[model samples]
Structures are given as C-alpha cells and as structure tokens.
Target: MAIMLYYPLIEPPRDVMYQGLLYWDMISTIVPDLADPDRESGWVRPSMMSPDMAAVADAGLYTPLSIASHVEPSVGIGGVDLTAKLRAALADLCSEMPERELKPRPAVEDPEQEIVYSDKLPPHCVDLLLENGLARVARREPMLIVSPAVHFTLLSVLARQLAHDLTAWQRVADRAEPCLPYTDQPWAFRLAHLPATGKPERCWQVELGGLLPVPDPSVPVSEVIAFRLKYNDERVRLVRAIRNLLRRLGGGEDPDEVFAELRAELADALSDLDRASQRRRVHWMRRSVSVLVALGSAAGAKVSPDYAWLLGLIGGYAVNVATTSMPSLPGDQGVDLSYLQRIRKAVE
Candidate 1:
C-alpha cells in the first residue's frame, strides 16, 4: 500500500498583529478627550502649585488647575496618569473582551501520515511516472509508498543557507524542480511492493532507483553549465557511496569510520564547488552534508526516523540532480516568433 505524509500550510501572524494594532489605535484616538489638557483643564494641575498643595490634591487625574490661578500643570497632558473617569472606561473596555480572546489561539494540527492505494494517483502523475520508468501500470497492485518530507527539508535548508546570493539561490530552485511536484504537495511515491508468494503474509520492501539521463540542447555550453554538470556528477557519486555505507552499517561496519569518510568526501565536494565559483551550490552541499552526517551517526544504532529522513532526502536529490541537468529537447522550439511579430505589428 502507498503511504502518504501530509503537512498543512500555516498562515502567518501578520493578520493577528494588524488586528491588535487597529484596536489599540482606535482606543488611543477615542480617548484623547480624557487625556488632552486643553479639552478639559481640570484633568491637568497647575505647575506653579506648592509641593504640599500638589501632594494633598493627589487625585487619579494628572494635575488639577485652580480656576483663580494661571499656573502651568506640573504633569503634561497625555501623560501616563489617567483621570478616574478615563480609567473606569478602560477597565470597562477590557472587561468586555472574552477571556478566550486574551490568550493565543491553539496551533494548527500537526503533519499527518497514512497508507493509501495506487489507484489514488492522479492520472497525469501516473502517466509521467510510467513514461519516466518510475512506475509500471501493468501491475494493478499497490506499491510501498514513501514520503518526500526529507527532500523538502533539504530544500528548505539549502534555500536558507544560500539566501544571500540571488543567482546561486535561483540555481538551487532550478535544480529542485524535478522533486518539486511531489514534495510541494501532500503526496507519496510507490517505493516498492511485495511479491505474491502465496504465503499467509507477503513481505513488502522499499527501494529508490538511481538517476535517469535526459536530453536538453537548449542550454548553451558555458562555464556555469559545465560547473553544474560536474557538481551533479560528484553529488551522484556521493549519494551512491552514502547508500552503500548505510547498507554496510546494518552488517556491523564501524559507524565512526564510515562517517569520517563521508565527511571527507563532502568537504572535498564543497571545496571543489567553491573553487568553481558555484557559491550557491556549495552552500547547499555544505549544509546538507553537515545535517546528514549529524543524523547518520545516530542511524547506525538502528533504523531511526532520522535515518529514513536522510535516505529520502539524498535519494530525491540524486534523482532531481540527474534529471534537471539534462539538455532541452532538440525539437522544442522556444518562444514563438509569430507571437513576437504580432506584438510588433500591434505596436506599429
């Protein structure tokens, strides 16, 4: 059966902030009559009043002006000190609010995981998968479903790490397109299915295939393209090595040794990318490998959540890198010249 993992999109807090600001501004505007000394001279006291008299006249209001005296009020208008009437109004306003409105609203529901059937696949997605050798439609049974959460996590890490460079960030976005369709939505992949052995219970397994080559001639030969091709090739090699090492870990290989080798390879790749002036790719590679290494250490003990996540991430990256770097199809003409001519005609 296919397994699906769904993460709900959450709205930002700006709406709540705007609501609060609007309430505060409205209250401030409506209460000015109580705080403005010019509007009500009694709300403010005479500034020239003796200290003893000022202390004796200590009311909730700021400073009370004597009608016979023309002394300035010690406390200025619109100060923190509020008249009894204004304070009562504020208390009433606060009391009018429900208790539930004072506290923060509960957070949205957490992400979910579930088992599903192969028939649930969208027609377009299934057709694309069949055309790309990702699935076989002849088999009417459901395959093991795998989540794309790891790939999404890696993309997030890459995006954040390389945000400073616009060109580099764009490259990362371009490279992420292959897995975007699956990862961007709440969907899963047909990892593998159990063979029918006529036993009481059949054993199902999960597996990911290596990269598939594509043809795209639209990309002209350039330093940037060359760098991308080389980087992707190196990444494929690293992914294969990681998969092999993870497998060996189950067979009692030394975790420390395997991790050390992986770290060294990752470092070398990062260095090479930096030398090639591929800053964005380098940032992504560095962050991805660092996280993988951290998570890989714990995975050696047993198959943990982190290990599964790392596998999905690396697997998705490997597949996307291979597919995204392919040259554009030769027969695919670019923007229609006729359309441009029509625009020019309209302009004339």
Candidate 2:
C-alpha cells in the first residue's frame, strides 16, 4: 500500500473528499518540508564544506558558533578565522598518515535524509526543512504526497525525480505504458493519466489538479494543479457539509445536550453511512484517455473528458479511480470533520 504524506500541511479536513478520501491506503502525520535550503539557509556562511553543500548545515548555522565565545584568550592570542591552526595542522598530519585505524568514525546515513533525494534537490535541503518544523517517520512503500499546491517548477522537479521512484510509474515506464495501477496493490489508483516515461511530467500535473483546490481564475490553468471544479462546487459542498456537521455536533459541546442529542445523532448517522456504503460498494474503474471525473460523481463526466493531450496525445492510455471505502470512522484527531467525511462517503 502506498503511504500518503502531506507536504506543507495536511489537506483541509472539509475537502478530504479529493485529498484524503482517494488513492492512498494509509494516512500519515509526517509533514515533509520541501523548502529548499539554498533559498532558506541564511544561517549558513563560509567555512562550509563546498558550494554543493550550500543546502547542508555548516558550522556557522548557529551563527557565532561559540568557540568558548572568547576562546579562553588562547594563552596568547586566538584570532578569528575560517580554520583554526591546530585543526589545520591536524588536517595536514592526517593527510600524511597512512593505514589509518584511528580515523574518525564513518558518518552513517540518517534515515531522515532519505526523505528528499534528487541530484537536483540538495541533501542539505532537509536541514533547513527540519529547522522549519518538518518532521519524519518511516514508510516501507513509496509515498503519494498530497497538498494544496506547490510552486510549478518545484512540482515538476519532484515529478521528474519521484516518478521513477514510485513503483507504479516505474512499472509503467519500464513497460512503456502510461497506465496506472488498476488495483490498490500499491495504492496509485487515480482519476488522471500520468505521462509516459521520458515525456514531460508537467502535463500530468495539470490533470492532477483535479484532486486539489481550485486555483484563482486570474491564474492560467496550465500554471497550477487544482481540482477541475464545476464553479467550485465540490469545495463549496465540502465547506457546507463541514458547517452543517459542526452545528449538529455542537450539541455535544454542552454536556447536557450531548446525551440528549449527540449520542442519538451519532448512532443514526453511523448506522446510515454503514448501510449506504455496504449497498454501494464502489471500486476502481478504468477511465477514458480524454475525460475528467467529478469529485462526487463516480459517473458524470466533467468539463474535460478528452485528456489525450495529457499523454502528449501520443499513445492512448487509461486512468484509474475508485470511491475507496473508508471502513473506519474519522478519529479524534480529525473529529471536527468527521461528520462531513461520513456524509460525503455515504453519498458516494
């Protein structure tokens, strides 16, 4: 199963329909900070390893990195410089030494550094990202990153690097096909066609916008990835659903009313949704090369149904989608949005 990791932050609870409700087999709390260290490392300075290590943390990262803050007056005079004489002399001696058994221990790879990897994405990027509230957990399977949006160039860079890493895309590329998995084996079932291997990944990104928030009208659609919404209907519907659910659950805020209303309402809605889901039992369906599926409509086609252009209009390809069943109810972490999620799932 593909693990879903949110970038920047988790998707808004209200619109979990497109963000949380599809594709991934599991949800995770690991918030990956993709922010570049090159752009963010104001804390770094010279005396760093190499230019390529600009993203890497340097001794200067903490700034004025306390050499006893005064260096004990050095017994004579300790001048401030990029390199210390004792350390500089040691480097020369180490260079002359041979068959070194006393060498410093080899630096082991930290599990965290494995999260972001690309010749283009600097290794030190994670250093800054971590400093800025990024966290990490481990996953054995490939990840499907979900977020509202990222810079277009960043998205494309991620696509190029990660497309090959993701098992689904790798299988497709190795087979020279643009198809995605029809089964949830790796949890890549989607509503859009990804570009064939060696083709530009940006086109695939445009179609992926169908699962994200709708972008502003002033922005060119090609410049971003947003849900190909019908007048922002899905977003509006999600927001409305959340609001309604809150009003009903608000009764629980008052202990007196909780017993009177919350318990009864909860029992009823759960019962209703359980019955609805069992009756519907929606599963993945193969999509035509040129169609866009609406958020709630497992059947109706949206504005664009001809997405052959997404594959460069080259070879024909198919996309996969399913109203993936959420057997478990939303937990306390997302309890506020529980009712809306239940309502949306029940209807679908």
Candidate 3:
C-alpha cells in the first residue's frame, strides 16, 4: 500500500510569482537539462534566462502538463528511486550536450586547499518554493497526480496570505518596544525562512486564528509598548528565578529559597518600571540582570539531568528573546510608529 500528499509551490502578491518565474527561467537556461533531462541536443543560452524573459513567461504562465514530475523529489530513503531516475536522466542529457565554462574558477589560496564543487542549488531557488503555487507532497510511490503550474499557483495564494499577516505583525512588533529585540532571533516569534536539508522551513509559526497575534492596528503605539513591557517583565522574572537557583547551587546550597527571593525582587523591578516616569527604566540593564540570574540557576542546579536540561532550554529562549535585535524586510526603509495610533479604531 502507498499514499501521497501534495502541496503546491507558488501563490499571490504577483511579485513572488514574478520572482519564482525569474529563478526558474535562470536555472532552466543555465541548466537546461533540468527542463528536459533527456534532451539529445540544443543548449539554451544563459543570456536568454534573464528577468525580462521570466516576466514574459509570467504574463503567459499556464499550468504545466504535470506538476508531480516538475516537483523535485524529497531527499531521503523514500526518494531513492526518484533521485536515481533524475540522475540518470541528467547524465544522459549531459552526455550529448557540449560542455562550456559556467563561471570564473576560484583562485587557489593554499596548496592543501582541495578544489570542491557545491551540490546545493543557488539561493534564488527559494523564490520558487516560497512563491504562490507549489504543492507539497508526501508519497509512498511516484505518480503524476497534478499539474505543476496549478499546484504552484494554488500554494502561492496561501503563501501570500501568510506573508501578508506576517508583514502586518511585523509592523505591530516594530512599534512595540518589548518585542523589538526578539524580532531577529530565530527562536523567538518572528517571520523567517530557514534552510533545512534542501528545503525552506517557515521558522515563525506564532499566530492566532490564522493571523498574527497583534493588537488592533488602531491601538495607540504607546499602549502596545506598555503591554509588551509588562509581558517581558514576566519573562524576566522567570529568568531571574532560574538564575538564583543556579547561583545557590554554585555555593553548594539549595536554590529553592533563592528562586523565591529572586521572584520577589523581579516583582519589585516590574513595579518600578511601570511607575517610572521615564521609559529608560525598563531598558537592557534591568533585563540583563534577570537573564544572568536565570543562566546562573540553570548552571548550578543539582537536580536530575532532565530537569536541568528543561531549565536550560527555557532560560535560553528567554535570554535570546530579550537580547536579540529586531528584523527588517528587504524593502523596508523604516516604519512610521505614529501610524499605530492612526490606523483603525482600537478593537478588543
């Protein structure tokens, strides 16, 4: 018995579609064998694979005859046969095509530096996977189940929706002081695409009801900032508790009491930040102390290895969220924080 799951590769803002087309055009031209693995002759000119050519294709982009065939197989034991098939097809095509210089050769730095070739596809390949209509599949056996263009187009639509929500959330977090530092940290909640094996992984999945967990756009930026400050304060306290416990262990003493005391101290600190006239009171200095304490506690704990490991993981996430910098998009010049208060009326 065999089963298969399919996910489309391309979907929605038009820009992503264009980019994916450009990437595909480039690869199909430079590596024409990719398009027709069994071609006996006729090599494509690399110059013909420009962004303009991609645009033309985008304008007339019709669903490919077979989506399953276009989809690169997964890279593992399950895909072993597919991988061999693809390799053999490419080998046959390449044997009949004339070889040409693809790019400038790298200069040798040291005699011992062995020349190596990268098997990984170019970075732009991400444009294809992240764009609007590519289908993702889980298969037990190979089969032509869908049109490539149709799957890509469908998936692209979903991806665009996700991207829009993420962008809006990014806007809100940029205005919120507490979330700003954690924006770029891969572990913290933020939009990111991480490479896993040969595929792209959506690193940020924090969402509420299919949308980003953010306050209404109309809410005053000040209120959002205040909310984040309070939220961060709680995390700070947790970090402190962990640290105090570790510090006590360092002195060959039990950390239970120290953890309780540190929690109390954190409560006081949060109070001070809340009532303080200046926002600077809640800056990195106060947060760093709490983080350090948590780290210390994790190090000094004499508990079972599992407990210690759990403590370490929590403390680490806290520290990373507290100290990391905010992320910015490619075209983002800067955000207008004032817009936060001007957008729609506040919603609960």
Candidate 4:
C-alpha cells in the first residue's frame, strides 16, 4: 500500500512540488470545506477544484484523495447522542456562512453571534471533524498531514489519550522551521538546444517553460560538467533514507516503539537536506575560486577575491561565488512530523 497523506485545505496551498514528490503513496489531499454548502465559490470540493487531478493521475503523478470520502461520519458520543448534535453543528456552520469581506470592517462593529465562515474558519463544527474527520483517517491508516503553516498548527502517547488530547497530539513545532531549498524557483532554468560554445553567457525566456541557455560565449565547462556533481552526495542518500523509512512504514507491521523509532530517525531529514545543500554550495564556491585563480594566471590577469566586480566579470559565465555564509539551520523537523506524532497517538 502506498503511504497516504492529507495536505491541509484545497487548491495546492504552497510548496506542493516537494510535498507531492516525497512522503506519499496514493498521494493527494482532500480537506473538506465544512462550510462549502454556504459559499457559492467556484468549486464544490477539493478534488473538483481544477485543473482536474485526473490528468496527473493518468500520468501516474498522484491521485487526489477526498477528505470527505476517506473519513466516516460521526456516530455519537458518551450516550449524549452526539450524532444529532454534530449534524446540527454541521448544518449551522455550513448554512450560516457570512459574506466574504472585500474591505476592512469598522473596529467598533459588533461581532456576529452565529457561527460563520470568514478569513479564519470557525471551529463550530470542529467536534464533528475531530470525531469523524481526522480521527477516523488516522485510526484506519498511518497518514502524514503536511502543511507549511507554522506558529499555528497535533497530540500524545499512552493511556489512550484522545487523538486530539494526547501530548503527541500537540501542534508541536517542527524540529526547526526550514526555509525552502530555493527561494523563488531558481530562475526556472532549461538548457538550450543550440550547440555549446565559449563566447558569452547568454540566455532568454522561451515562450513555454523558462530561460533556455544558449551557451555560445560562456558557461564554464568545469562548472557545467561538475553541475551534476555537487561534491556532497546526500540527496541520493536522503532519498534512499526516505524510501527505506517508507518501506518500513508500508510493508512491515512493526511494533509501536520500532515504528516510532524509524520515524524519529527521519525526523531531522529536512534539516539534514538543508545542511547538505549548504555544504554543496560551499564546495561549489571553493571549486570556482580554484578554477578562476588558474584561469587568471594563464590569461596573465591578476585576480583577487575582494574585487567582486572583476569576479563577476570573470566568473559571470563560470563561477557561482559564495558571498555571505548561509545561516545555521534550525531543528524544525517540519510541521508534518508533529501530525505524524498525532496520527500515532490517534491510532493507539
């Protein structure tokens, strides 16, 4: 069985590329808009919010799982007839969505007493979601709940703590919050089809994907060739670790402690990946300097590291120099790990 996960909300909130690639089996998300009935928004459900997932599924990318479909409806609670109360709550929250605000409201305005949908979803139907939504999904399957949201966001261990109550069930922060590997997509690069030459570093945006590099004048052979070799080969290692961890998670029905241990082993994988990237960059810079020094001597030009303009002129087509040091990575295991912790508790 593929490892399944629920990314919070609908419409691919953020960083879905990495989220989709890693940590999923029949991967997709289906967070229900409990107030969906009230809003006349574009779509009815998460899966229906196009571009349809069918094309991706056909390509074997990943299938979208409906939150509504995966979870069972709440039955009852404490002989208090929670079913009726929850049904009532759902009705109230769904039917009572307030108008979506386009402008800021007056500060002195009185708040509406009724449960309504707004910027922040009201937790009026939270009980129903807990009993049926999150609880059922976690109990039946070990799922990962991945989200980028921080400072806002799982539960505990033994003694049969409520999935929502336990210590592991806490919205505990990740080992550390990680800034993405790349800030804004790294200039969406693509190699041009033109024959390679060493003239000048030139590139242009294609109508379709991204910048296509026509390396007529420039692009250093050493850097270009060594591009594939990042000096630090941790990506493959990390990928292997993820696969191994998931394999254990998938096929083996290990004891709770063993399972927990495996996950804990990977808890810092994100930090490790970042650290590896930092090291690779450091290697890249040092290698570039070495190449430039050799080239400068051969060309009968004195090159100094402090002359950034000269470095840029010399290395523009060649080197990617290291400027400021990368900040030390924090311990945030990422938000998903906490949800995993919650799932473990809920299932128990």
Candidate 5:
C-alpha cells in the first residue's frame, strides 16, 4: 500500500574543455611507449605531435584501455594512473567481482554511460517498473517488499516518503469523525499475521521490526482525523436514523444501546496509541496495510479507506500529501501520493 518515491535535481553537463586529460592519461598508461614530442618525456608530457598522430595514438589504446581501465586502481609509486587498481578495489568492495564482469558501456561516448552491474539497477529501470505495475499480476502478493537491489542512498528516499505519508494520514484522519478524542493518545502496536495463499504460506513481513516515535512533531496535527471521526460517528447516526424501522420489526433492545456497544468496540480497537512504541507502530502501519489488502483479497473482503491510508503509509505518499503544499504534488495521483515527495518538499 505504501508508495515510496524520490525527486532529485539533476544537473546537465556544462560547457568546458575536457582537455582530453582522461584520454591522454588513459593512453599514457596503456601505450606509454608511443611518442609525443610536445613537452613530455613521460606521464607529465604534453603532446605536440600532429593532432592526427596524437589522435591515432589515442585511438590505438582506446579500445584496449577501455577494456582494461577500472573504476579504481591501487596506490602507485608516484600516484600515477591507478584506474585499474581502483576498479579492482571497487569490484572487490562490490562482492569480489571478477575482472571479466561484463559492465555496461555505450558504443558512443555518452556521459549517461556510467557504471552498470548485474545485481544493481540504474535509474532507467523506473519506466519498466511502473509499466510492470499495470500489466503484472500482483507480483509477490500485495506486500510492498523493499528491493535488495536498493542501496543505502535509495533507502534514504524510502525513509523520507514514509515520514510524508504519516503526515498526510494524520491530516485526513484528524478531519474525520468521532475523532480519537485527543491529539496525544498513546498507542502500542503489534504485528498481526494474515496467511498466504500460495506455496510460501506466509504473508509479507517487516525485515526490521520495532516501535518508533512520531517522526515529525513540528508538522501540525492533520485535519483528516476529524473527518474520520465524523465518518465513524455516522454509523451511530445512521442506526438512530433508522431506529423506527428496527422497532417496527420488534427488536428487543433500544437501538441506541446496541449502537453504543458497536461504537465502543470500534473505539476499543482504536483506543491505545503508545507514543513510546511509535517506531513499531509506524512499521506496523507500513507493512500491515499491504498484508491486510492481500489477505482481504484472498478472503474476498472489501477494502476500505483505512486500507488506502495503509497504502499511503507503506509507500510514503501520505507524507508527501500531508507535508507538502498541495501545489507541490505531482499531477499523477500515484506519484503525488509518494511519501518521498512529502519528505522532499518538507526538506526543500
């Protein structure tokens, strides 16, 4: 149910002379024997040979050097070109990858052609992901499982979105009816299970489980809480509205008494909100919604607005809606609803 998102400001390339240093340096490393008469005896030399000759020398090594050069190389005797060593280190850091790993490279020189790895996905994968959401048949059940391919940098995006969703939900829920009577209600949260349909026979679970505090107290309490309270209140109102109908059918108890019990049960379900357990509550909020929806669908129960609330929390869209000025939201409902957007706007 939760939808996490991130919006970053990307800068395009600037117009400056590349000076072909990487080119020269790269060539120098691979074909140090090639002569350049401009100013050099070695790696420090400037190339004065005809641009054509220099180009040829550069080209001679380009293909091989491209294949050989790495992201990082080792410390050298005089800090000379160490790209090969550096690359090895990076590969090792990335789980001891072999030198032969087939990394992504464009035929033409494109700044966009950056590092590519088999286990990692680039930004370009976004379109495919969104497309799959539409055509795919509820992959891995209804849970919003975080991708292992995700990096710490990316998880930051998810954290931000989660905060945003909380804010938005607070607003909307506050505005609803029979409001939880107080803003400072203490809550305690626990994870509940919904059995899985397929072979695994289990529902989505939080990898990190714990209680958390309210992420942002600076933001104003949400208006939606009041609205939700109002909506729930209507249950009683509606029961009363049709009291005569019930009486005509010879009901045993006063309609008000019966409604009072139902209302009390609903209230009890919502009664405790332990701020001390806020972290656990938030995580529960995030993971539970997705599981519930999956369970409900499996069991054929209709989802409610509360389900939507959970989705927002799990995905971080609610935070965006809550913290951001409405204008800051994306035109697309799905994108706008991301918790990340809310965090981004709040911080921005």
Candidate 6:
C-alpha cells in the first residue's frame, strides 16, 4: 500500500486544524522545552522522550541535558574571545580532511532552529489518515471524522506510557477479580465509519490496557517495522469549588456531606441565571458554564448538577446580549447568537 505521509503545519489552510490541535497544543504541552521536529537539531533526547517512544530509540543515542542556574564569576578574566581562532583552525582542518570515513557535523549558529520528526504518529497526525485518497482531501472537514481502521492505528500509537499505566491498573483489578480481555468487554468496542457505503462500523478498541513489568522493557523490535508511517491552557476561577470538592475528592479535606451541599448551592445559582428575561443572555451564560462542567466532568466530577451553573452563566450572558441587540449592530453583526445558545444548552 502507498502510505500517505502528511507533514504537519506545512499545508497552510488545509493543515490549520492539525497545526492548532497537534503542533500548537499537544506537542507543546507534552514537550515544552524542546525544538519541534521542523527545525534542525530539534531533538528530544530518547531517554527524556514521552513515556511511549523511549524504547524505540537505540540505547545510547538519546540522553538528557542538564540545566542549572549559577551566579556569575566575581573575579574571572572576561577578555578571551575564542570564536575567530576556533573557526579558522576547524575550517583548515576540515578542508584538508578526506570525505571518506566521516562527514563534518554542521556548525551551530542559530539556537532557535527546530527539528521535527518522530517515529510514531501522535494523535493529530493520525487524523490525516482520514484523507485516504487524494480525492477525499477536497471533501468538507474530512479530518473531522475518521475510519475505525485509522482510529485503531491512532490509539495503538498513543504513548505506550498510557498502556503501561493501564496494565498496572489491570493487575490490581485482576487481583480483585479475574480481568476479562478487552475484546470481551462491551465498552472496549469503538465505533468507526466504513468508506464507500458510508455506514457505521464497530471494532475492538485498541489494546492500550495492560500492566507492565518492573523496569519497563523496550517495546518488541518487530512492532516498529510493522507500522507503515507516522506522524490546553485553563485556570480554575472558583476557589471554593476546588477547596470543598476537588480537595476532598483529591484527599485533602473532609466528608461527602459538605461536597454534596456545595453542589446543590451551585445548581441553584445556575437555575437563577437561566431564568433571566433575555433568552440570549441566559444562553450566553449557560454556554460558559457548560464549558466548565465539561472540563470538570472530564476530570470525573458530577456534571449534571453543575450543568445548571453553566446553563445559568451562558443563558444570563446570552439573554443580556440579545436584549441589547448587540450582535445585530451595524458593523459587527456577524456573531451567531443562536449557535452560541445551542452550544450552551448542550452543556446544560
């Protein structure tokens, strides 16, 4: 099969979504200090690589760098400039050297140059597989949906760290009860869409779960050749919410009663916000609240009760905006109030 290798951040308008989600956010968050593969020498030491790809590297090729702060020397002689001498001597020697055994390494000049290639596909990279044929790239938002075959490849490629963690988790669970294989579990199946017929499909989710043995061994060497190709910011505003609920659930504070009571209060506040006279304002308020609930829910919170807070916030804001006819103003009437309201309601 001819593998489609799409370069991230290179295709301009067509690649914007990939760049935004994978390059700008995922890559940066996961590895903040290193240069992206797009730049020369933009290497992330294999040892320091994300929990997944560490084993893929040859043993000695990857190593971490050390960083530390130091006070300037108080009385050192600061007059030696070694650049001119070093360059001239190296250049003469390099020019005389035969180009048989070794190639000279490039000189370091710009510190900001990047280097961007990796062995496996990251989440956003797999999205490109949705563009199976050249013809599909022209379709509207093809990357937005993908095939089960592609998803399997994607999930299988996620950081092996996640697999290792799951495996360890399973060991404990197994002790409690004999663990069933992923294929036997109902929730382990993922939904995919078949091409041509455009029908929904189901398949076993990628096997990312398992407990790793101590001193995590390298991934089997055979797996690397089998694969064809490759390759958030938010702050909490509510101090009390963290203190009363997250802290307790996270194992810092007190009992369940207090957390439950606070939840009820937050819901009432949301309800009050939703009842505002301006439907647009209420909708806007709810949308904002919904985002919070979604985030909290993703973190394992009970989002139903908190849904009110989001509803109230989005609704109150939407109604206020509608009542003022702000979005309908002369120059800036492009805002989609109805769309915003629907989003807000979804969270509620």
* Pick by TM-score: 1 or 5, better one: 1
lDDT of 3 at 137: 24
lDDT of 5 by residue, 256-327 (tens): 344344434333322332222242232112111100101222321221222211111211222110010111
Residue 220 in candidate 5, Cα distance off native in Å: 20
Model 1, 10-126: lDDT tens digits are 110221111111111110000001224454532323353334223322422112222112111211121211122222222332355453432222331222221112322222333
Q: How far is 244's C-alpha from truth in model 5 (Å)? A: 34
Q: Identify the leading candidate in terms of TM-score.
A: 4
Q: How many residue pairs clash in each candidate?
A: 10, 5, 32, 25, 68, 37
In candidate 5 the C-alpha lDDT for residue 30 amounts to 15
TM-score of 6: 0.22
TM-score of 4: 0.26
Residue 12 of model 5: what lDDT?
Answer: 10
* TM-score for candidate 2, residues paired by index: 0.21
Query: lDDT per prediction?
Result: 0.24, 0.24, 0.25, 0.25, 0.21, 0.21
Residues 81-154 of candidate 6 have per-residue lDDT tens digits of 11222222223323544432112114322211112111222323323332322011222322223222222222
lDDT of 2: 0.24
- Tens digit of lDDT per residue, candidate 3, span 1-348? 000011122111222222122111111111212234553233223353444434433444312212222224322112223233223323332354332311112332321111111111122222332241221221322111223222222222222222222334445557321111111111111112111111221111111110012333343334434444455554344334433443353343433444345545544543543444134332221111111111222332343332321111221222111111122222221220100111122112
Candidate achieving higher TM-score, 4 or 6:
4
Task: Report how far off residue 134 is in candidate 4 (Å).
Answer: 19
Worst 10 residues of 6 by lDDT: 206-215
Off by over 4 Å in 2: 5-13, 17-23, 28-152, 168-274, 277-348
Model 5 TM-score, 2 decimals? 0.16
